[model samples]
Target: MDHALIEASLGELTAANSRELERKCEQIALSYIAQLVEPQFDVDSADFARDPRLICADRYWNLRFQAAPTLATAVDCAGWMAEHVVAAVQDPIREKWAMGYAFITRNSVESAAEIADATADVVAADDSACNKAYFAALYHAGKLRANFFYDELEIFLAASPLALAAGPHRESVLFTALRAFAAFGSRTTVHQHGCALLDQMWNSAERTFAATDVVLNGLAAGKDFDGRAQLLRDRSAEAVAAYPGRDILHFRLATGRWMCGEYDAAMADIDEALRLLPAIGWRVSHELLQGQYLARRDAIEAARAADRQARIDRDRVQSTEREVDRLAGEVRGTVLRAVELVTVFAAVIAFAVGSLNVSLNGNITLADRIWIVVTQGVGLLLFAFLILGGSWFIADRLARRSERRDRPED
Candidate 1:
């Protein structure tokens, strides 16, 4: 395949409807698999690692797996990465493969455990904090999905100090540790530990409010929301002062005020946020908040309208389902009738064949026998085609009926 064509197809794949995208991806993947299975294709070559087609194929498969996480895709992709990409590559590419493997296997405990076990030697020997932290983050992510792998989480946490000592990965290690603690640590202790880590990270010489925002977001979702609003408010004010004109800080402040039941203040901040960042999503969110505020003010009218709309929507859905079921039943009946006709036709053909054999006997001319066979064969084939065609016609009619029924009234 031409690289430009492949790239264009990939772009189209991204923009295609979900059903069409799945079909396109399957076609692309099969093409890649064909290429991969060719005897001349060098799976171990550096050139293969750098090949654009191979890279695109890898990305396509990864996207498919990410879109729908399944054991089969995970196993296949992991195997391909390990054998065809990782094994053939060096340094940065190899590191990416390791990280990719960890990410792809995060949902499967067995796969993740295998990865940790396989890379233990390298992870132990490597003194780079960034690499260790990267690996630890991967394991920590896996631990989140697989509750039985607390040991993996512990191992990563143990390596945190090494990551902290090395400056490059200090923040990453801390964030990963915070995530682990939030996930598995005792609720009472986890919050305190997270807060301490949050403080340490924020108060460091090179302070990152963005990172602090991440930790605070996690904390906001926790059980202890009593003082979190105040904490968020203080942080939001500080961040705003530090990074003036940042819409996100205003959004953060709005979230804090919303949580604190200060709707007016929250709306005010949301307005500012919207003014700074006039995104459709933000507008939708603002409108939703406004609706909520309105509902709070006029509960009775809002509830009545909501109940009426719910009933209308429910009845519409039920009606559509009934229509679909009716159409499906008709299709099934048509199919059954077609089957019966085919069966009857088969019996008639069998009877005719037997009768012809008896009448013709061994004395029949070779040309006559050939003619009879050909005519009977053609007749049976034509009848089979008619049966199939009739069934499809019924199905098509039913589908058209369904589409007409489903179309919304203007």
Candidate 2:
């Protein structure tokens, strides 16, 4: 982001003749647009980031508003700060988290302020300050570029207006916090800052707001995919708990749970988001959140249908594999049975040949020899029949047993 255009535009605004200055803020507005369309830098480079939105500084805003709040001076002061104050900038204000944060922050301040008005209702530390001083301070904060988490916020606001009217020699604390939270920073510092920002609901005027994306994105950037998911999920859940029934909060929470890695849980969250979407907030239909959410619903439903089919296919494959294993077992058993039968027959033949040799070697009559041959032949035939009949009987019994199991009994 070559912010030379911002300084140059501010200078141009000062030099414009009365008539031209009164016409429009075309140059200042266009300068911001041009920066937005600038070509992106490499990710590893120090300058590689979407530029933060410009904001008005707190300096001298009190004095200006004290006289009379005019639109012209407000624009002039904003331009002046962009030139002089390093920046009172924040990340762009479009995240669901940021939008939801804005909605909740606005309500939280109002609710807390109301309690502060009533002596008996104040319980929590954040809302316990019932003094007019606290209300006055909060009023000032809301009126002119509220930094809800400024260090020594009370003392700074209590200080004399003239003392607050100094040129900023360094970056505004908000920009510093945003920069640290967004890009790479010390792990411990980023975590501490992110958690602190999460705790405090932010309220800013339309032009002067800090984007919660600075914290949300920074926290996510510090971690890997699953860690990022869990962190966002927990944070969004906390927000939902604090302010229940906000549709945007539910939408953000589901997306955070997140990113479809935990399929079933993520799917459930998406369904809830789709169910809770509101039916309004349209200026141009194209810009409406409802349109965007409808498109998202279509995509999520498609993903869910695909997820269902994938599980069905997986189950079918598992079932087929089990059947294959059973068939393989039967084939293995048959092969083992055949090998055993062959081995037994071979042993019986060897013994019969040995006995015949022994009988022939002994001195004996021709008749004796005939009798021995007949007996031996008969014995061999009987042994063969018995062995084959035993194998057949065993196979028949096994088939019957299997058939019985396969057919359900009446």
Model 1 agreement with the true structure over 1-410: per-residue lDDT tens digits: 56456556655554445455545545666565556531112233333123433444444554554554443343344444444444434233433333344345456444455444444533444344344334344434333423434334445444544223324543453344345335333343445555666666667665544444444545544445357778777767677788777565676776666666565666677667656652332112335444433443343334446666888998999797987778787778777677868766785777587557845778877877777777776777777777777776876777778677767779
Which candidate's lDDT is highest? 1
Clashes of each: 0, 0
User: How far out, in Å, is residue 32 in model 2?
Assistant: 27
Q: Please, what are the lDDT tens digits per residue for candidate 2 over residues 253-358?
A: 6666545345456556656655665432211222344554565556556776787899899778766765765575587468547855775676478557856775
What is residue 97's positional error in candidate 1, in angstroms?
Answer: 14
By TM-score, who's the top model here? 2
* CA-lDDT, candidates in order: 0.52, 0.42
Report the C-alpha displacement of residue 398, candidate 1, in angstroms.
Answer: 84
